[model samples]
Target chain A: MSTTLEPTDRTRIRRGRNRAVADRTELHALLADALVAHLGVTVGDHPVVLPTAFAVDADGPDEGGTLYVHGSVGARWLQEAGDATVCVTVTELDGLVAGRSAFHHSMNYRSAVVIGRARVVTDPAERQHALDLIVDHMIPGRSATLRPSTRKELAATAVLAVPLHEASMKARAGGPVDEPEDVAAGIWGGHLPLTRVVGAPVVDHQTPAEVAVPDDVRARALHRA
Target chain B: MSTTLEPTDRTRIRRGRNRAVADRTELHALLADALVAHLGVTVGDHPVVLPTAFAVDADGPDEGGTLYVHGSVGARWLQEAGDATVCVTVTELDGLVAGRSAFHHSMNYRSAVVIGRARVVTDPAERQHALDLIVDHMIPGRSATLRPSTRKELAATAVLAVPLHEASMKARAGGPVDEPEDVAAGIWGGHLPLTRVVGAPVVDHQTPAEVAVPDDVRARALHRA
Candidate 1:
């Protein structure tokens, strides 16, 4: 079965030039690769945006997959977002596109935007599964290495589930596209790609020396490099 | 002259645990290191967040510095954000902290949150200067090589200025803070640091071979590597 995103009224790209990646497979891959998401929700009249860890199950039963996000029970945003409409955005800065003119300079990036009303995950079983997905999303096979969340810990956390029905991913890549006149001006212009890498893991000071770095952690850190 | 941010009612972090970097000097440094910012503004009743390029003027007349953000004139968010309150957040994810238990897993990040009303920059000269600052902010000395914006181009852009007076920077560094009980379980737990690096510039295929890469571009790519 081919997984494709059905664009809704809110998902349609109003700015024609900003639409880069429209294929569902490519958009899903971009969302899966992102480690964090910026969640936006209104509190009273003002809007607050937070950088948060999130997970999306691409191969799940849901047609377009579902985005999972969690926060402290005491968080004001969390309180305001109870069954409220929200916008979750994930952006990866890929490169800097330097054009020969000041107005043409731009950045190459892959960004996904999801708009939906988040429903609080209340079922204990589903909540546990969602938590596992989040942990594994950060580090593959990480959920198996750690102990399960306690009842008290689960009660202190608030997880929101937003279906990926209204979502779109836009991307820009490759070199600078300067105008013909600017290109002939002889000013050097191109693109500098930026990459995100992982460094060596630092073990906890209190942990015993026998506790070695797990295969999952070591593999992810090395894979990024 | 010290450029320190003053915390206000809206910017003051209510959640004490989330307040990581309270010192203004350290917070200012964290903001300077970020490349992109997430802007949150209300469109009608819904909140929309956009990942955008921004510039901060630390040495300028503004006390805590001013954040300059520009967008297309046709954008709905830009049209609705005329002298309205907004939130600008810049986050740099430093590392992933894997704890011995699922509940304690967290990320090490440096984030700055600025909450205030943004004013539309109407002055032509100030707007041009802001545009240059944004270009040079992405790549140092980049604005001088590029041709200045034309009258039409200037008219097509909407620049907003938000003073950094009501802002706060919060950061979390180092390894995972696992509980003693979980640590005794012998699970491998630590933090994997993430770094952003820049790759070699790829010149446009249509450009002539004689157009060598500028010193600033070469230095930036090498420094990131």
Candidate 2:
């Protein structure tokens, strides 16, 4: 994989060009950090966007890499997305930039957009690996502790892969760019940094009293802290 | 405005219909809580999804209400979005559902998708109001403190409104629904609740020492807590 992102005609940043990041590593980092991705596909004559859990594999079988998003086989949008052109976007809100003027007030965020043709993973071995990655992406070491997916469960799920070749990332950080006049007016301006807080795990009602919270789950809570 | 969400042919939830929310109040609540919305628009032949800050007006001059998203007038997508069919989605991840088996693992989230024709706000009064709502949406009572937007600023920004007439919301909460056999096996299964944490406001370097962090900003952090 190339170290820099190769922006295609559609992936090029036309607006807010100053915020664009050419580094491919940043795209991977943003995708890894984001838990959900919004998948866009044309349904009939209109466009539809839906949120889904996503996982990325840097060395997967795709042009640059593979971005995996799974849904039920019965999902109409997912079925239509197969072999069709799609756009996947992942965004992480970092902070709220408070400027002296409302015009300058903005959000500090890292966002990536990838445009490609969706490929349904038909290979059993690769499909299984992608499923594991999706599980572990949410909670590290999670899939290993759970029972294997049954054939019926596997058949019900459908995984779609989009190549990471034509991708572009843009990010904004730090304080807002307020006008010099506003800054000179002594108005308070900065940012309120936001972070995702993972709370304590609540035991399922069906779990036996003897079963304890696993190490991986506990670690996830602590790591976020 | 009706109390229930009016799902059109495109906005109706097909897959995971169990999670679909019919209450319009729930859609309003989710839109109020979410800071970013992913907008999907078909540009040329492919669909493109991008994240933008959004605000909702419950009694705006639209069919049910109005959902507002703003961007630079120079933005190509925003320009193309006018009078075009667009999809706006807002999602909030509530928790991670850990099931006894890999097949049952899922995420608890509230997501709303609105499909409608985008109308660029032309009236100066409504456009100004939308801009203020966009600002106050980020930090409550923020626009009141900031200086009024100049004509140049107003000209540079473009606000698009999508009626809330055709919208659908889906939410999943609590623990995962594991199979009876998996639950009987005594495997630990539950959920890790996720919350958005707003950290201390970092003062801009350019701000005078006399200028203190505003009360609204401090209140925002406390409210999120």
Candidate 3:
């Protein structure tokens, strides 16, 4: 776990005036918490973005780096985008930051945009590991409980790992930004926050009778409503 | 609303062989329920996407047609992207669909991408309606609860409404896509559902006791846990 790159572009790509996190660890944590990301790539002259369930590789957590892993090779998007530069973005919607004035209206959100070259993963061991990370990223400790992939399954799959040492984050939290002119307008502008919580776990109808919720699954569930 | 002059190419973009979603109503529902969207555009040659809170104004039902509404003036994007061809994507991560094979792994996701000229809303009445729609989108009863926007606030702000009638929706759901040949592989792969919901309500520190949580607001708190 050696420190590799220091975040530059503070002047240009820094959080700017917003309160979104930019630290690699914080960014990685946010990526770890998110279940999916919107991956943007240019398809011909058109920009195409796909919703994907991605995972951060557990084996590569050193140096403030993040490796996002996602699958399904049949996507026409990956076919069109061989090794193109892409932007993978993940957002955690904490709540809506409602303000009085329509101008001051906003949301409380945390988002990260990773810009890098996209390559289809080929290594067997790494691909398998990436798949495990994808599983564990969803439910922290379920990867071990699931059966491992077969050789043929590995061969037919495609996973990409992008190092996120260079990226940017933008966020808007708190109530609102009311100008001096707006304050006197007598509008009771403030924050109406929106939050997302976990609901009571609905057991999959197909689960067998003997299988109960595992400790890891219950741990993740405790955080939600 | 009369059907506006919409080009064919504007509506039907390229297709994703395994991921293409041809349903029009499905796309509209996804857009209506989504509270935010990622606005993807090119900055110079690099693809830069900004995730902003957005709301869609459905002229009628989900399929009757809708328009995306978002605010910000003086922002480089809203200013530079006056009626320029842009891609606005809305997505809802319903659940995680684990696959038996690595290639079949995917998510239960519904995403809509609209490629068109995002016109800056100019009419005062329409702008107010758009603003109200944006608020109403986040909280169904918020627009009526808050005071209306002032003339000065309206003068400085801009809202872009992108037509949703000409948009395309793509989705993937259900259990793993198991290849017949690999059905005997014994990889216990299946979907792991994920969702976000409302947690315990934290009253605003300054909230007045006089104004209690209305049925609309309290209903979210008492929603099924």
Residue B102 alpha-carbon offset, candidate 3, angstroms: 5.8
| Candidate closest to the true structure, highest DockQ | 2
Which candidate wins on TM-score? Answer: 2
Per-candidate DockQ versus the true complex?
A: 0.73, 0.84, 0.31
Query: By descending DockQ, how would the candidates be arranged?
Result: 2, 1, 3
What is the TM-score (0 to 1) of candidate 2?
Answer: 0.99
lDDT of 2 by residue, A144-198 (tens): 8887899999999999999999999999999989999988888899999998989
Query: Each candidate: what lDDT?
Result: 0.81, 0.92, 0.63
Q: Which residue pairs in candidate 3 collide?
A: A95-A194, A96-A194, A197-B197, A198-A224, A198-A225, B98-B191
DockQ of 2: 0.84
Candidate scoring better on DockQ of 1 and 2: 2
**What is the per-residue lDDT of model 2 for residues B81-199, given as tens digits with 9 covering 90 to 100?**
99999999999999988888878889999999999999999999999999999989999999998899999999999999999999999999999898999888788889999998889
Better of 1 and 3 by lDDT: 1
lDDT of 1 at B125: 82
Chain A TM-scores, one per candidate?
0.94, 0.98, 0.84
For each of the candidates, give the backbone clash count: 0, 0, 6
Give stretches of model 2 more than 4 Å off. none
**Structure candidate 2, residue pairs in collision:** none
